[model samples]
Target: MVFEYILKQNGIHPQNDLTIDQSIDFGSTAAAFAGGNGDFTVEFEPGATSLESEQKGYVVASLGKDSGYIPYTAFCAKKSYLKENTDLIQRFTSALQKGMDYVQTHSPKEIAEIIQPQFPENDLKTIQTIVTRYYEQGTWKADLIFEKESFELLQDILLDAGELEKRVPYEDLVTTTFAKKAVK
Candidate 1:
């Protein structure tokens, strides 16, 4: 959906311009591209960096940087559950906001050092490179707020893809109250 939207935005018809190999699963795309399966590939984070580092692929483009605002990650909970656990949700959201703040304020290498424990398989330098790439690409926001404009853009993408039958209003699915009140 994202790739198709990007293609259309750039005046390229996804269906008519080129054949995008949808056969490769998300995880295997880097390896497949490395094996000469596709002319180009869209990868996120470590995969792209790893590909270039391994001399299999070249980092050419950034879809997210070019795609505009995307509300890719959200902390979702059932309304009932949310109502029952507002305090817990607030704390969770607050923690996430802090994480965002940390990413925004710290250098990529510094952030990488702290997060290296989470990804033990990757060496510190690789983690730093990945962090630098994401940081440079503006992947992380300084806050946890899911803006209405981003929601609308997502709906537009979904509508263009024929995945959404009707446009859902942002208020119906989003609430910025928690994010707004989240401890800074």
Candidate 2:
């Protein structure tokens, strides 16, 4: 969705019927599904029950391209909620940090093993490859840096598409304090 927003900022609409048919190859998964890319050629299978078919002509790009986590719990809150529910926000922030810590500390092999039995048809090496790619770009930021960047990129696209009427201050859209607090 971030990339889609960025593309729109650049005046490149995925659904625009232009002479050129450019595809944004987002592989299948739950998030991708929600972001409106679930119909893409590649996707994650549930329970590894089916034979893995290698789809030709599709480029495989890792989602961890500049990967990082957004503290939606902190940034997505209404101003009133943030002001009144700091402790709840902090606890959610801490949980995200813990998950990131686990990912950071775990080896690709271990992670592969953990997820492998459920998806037995897929290769462990492939899973490990995905896990490593995620680790390389991923970080848990309570400040929501990546999400802010994504939104900024999206806003730019919206503006280019004339979907937005004016410039929105990026700093006004997201908070950085929670990430700063969590890191400390």
Candidate 3:
């Protein structure tokens, strides 16, 4: 959808100019591109960084940097679970916000060291690169607030893709109360 948005921005309709080739996985997509089967594919994180490092691929553009604050991740809960676990949710969001705060203040190397234990199979260098890229991109939000503009951009993407029949109100899609309190 982001790709479609970008294409449209450049006055190219994806349906007309692009041939959609769906790959089951990033590795396969990279492999296909490397093997001359396709011209380009979008890759994320370690894979994208690794490909460039190994001289297998080069990035044409960074979607995150170009699009600006697309809100890639969200915490969701069932209404029943949310109603019953408001305190738990608050605690979790608070901890997450604190972690974001830490990332914002610390060097990428320091942040990588803190998370390296969980990714034992990945080498320190790769982890550090990923962390550095994310830090430089401002990928993590210190505040949990779900911005209406970002959500509306997402909705526009969905609508353009024909995935949404009509615009959904922000109030219906999100509850900002907890996020508001969490930031405080």
Q: Give the whole-model CA lDDT for all candidates, comma-separated.
A: 0.88, 0.53, 0.83
lDDT of prediction 1: 0.88
Candidate 2 per-residue lDDT, tens place, 36-151, comes to: 54343333332121212232223344322422232324348788998998888878776766666666677867877787887666677767765654555453332333356666
In model 1, what lDDT does residue 129 have?
A: 91
| Sliding window of 10 residues with minimal summed lDDT for model 3 | 22-31
| TM-score, prediction 3 | 0.91
Q: Which residue segments of model 1 deviate by more than 4 Å?
A: none
Tens-digit lDDT string for candidate 3 (1-184): 7887878987988888878787457567766766777777788766777777888888777788776678788878888889999999989888888887788889999999999999887888989998988887778877889999989988888898899999999888788888888778
TM-score against native, each model: 0.95, 0.54, 0.91
Worst 10 residues of 2 by lDDT: 47-56
TM-score of decoy 2: 0.54
- With candidate 2 superimposed using the best TM-score fit, by how many Å does residue 75's alpha carbon deviate from the native? 5.0
Q: For model 1, name the residue pairs that clash.
A: none
C-alpha root-mean-square deviation, each candidate: 1.2, 7.0, 1.7
- Sort the predicted structures by TM-score, highest score first: 1, 3, 2
Clashing pairs in 2: 8-157, 9-156, 9-157, 143-179
Residue 34 in candidate 3 has what lDDT? 67
